[model samples]
Target: MANDKTSHEIGIDGAILATQVPGNNGTLILSIQQTSALNNWLLKWANYLQNEQTPRNEWLMTTILIKSKSLKIEHKIAGVSPQKIPDSQYQAQGQRVTWVLMAADIQTT
Candidate 1:
């Protein structure tokens, strides 16, 4: 896909650094306001990854599809799961802090 001809033609492979995981351990950074429902769900999600003893592979495994012609970072991310979610912290300016979730076994197509 790197057949250079014109600009803005870079494929998905070109965005990635290499076969290894990108810096920051492929963490998906997210944050939710205190009033948002996702704030609760995010806490539960992190708890599940930390406390759940038996991980149901069939149910927990997920696939994420993203589409964006603007930046050309669209791809189907499969086998997504909560790899690591440490303590939740908030900034002085905002009530909700950014949570980093590490996901592995990602494949783009």
Candidate 2:
């Protein structure tokens, strides 16, 4: 799913809520978290809100807990961390992180 929202809205509220829904097989809190994280990171890192890539289809969501406190900056600046959930178990594809979701695995929380 593609989302065009701020990181705070998606990450703090959206992701947290998504982490509480049940799926066809069972509850998929983990998937929700991962997806939320992916979306959140993209918003912050890729800066998709301003100038976005057209036909943005190829993207990935990774399950990443905050590695210590995250510092939200334009790019990589020194000694800056924001309030984030640390110690994430992010699953990565290549050098980037993404959350792979199954068809039946939908988040309700």
Q: Which candidate should be chosen as best, given lDDT against the real structure? A: 1
How would you encode candidate 1's per-residue C-alpha lDDT over 42-81 as one tens digit per residue?
A: 7676677556585666434655677787877766555556
> What TM-score fits each model?
0.49, 0.17
Clashes, model 1: 0
What lDDT is obtained when candidate 1 is compared to the true structure? 0.54
lDDT tens readout by residue for model 2, 1-109:
2232223325644563223333222111222343465656744644442236633432323222223345532211222222223234546632332332222222222
Q: lDDT (0-100) at residue 41 of candidate 1?
A: 74
lDDT of 1 at 18: 28
How high is the CA lDDT of each candidate model? 0.54, 0.33
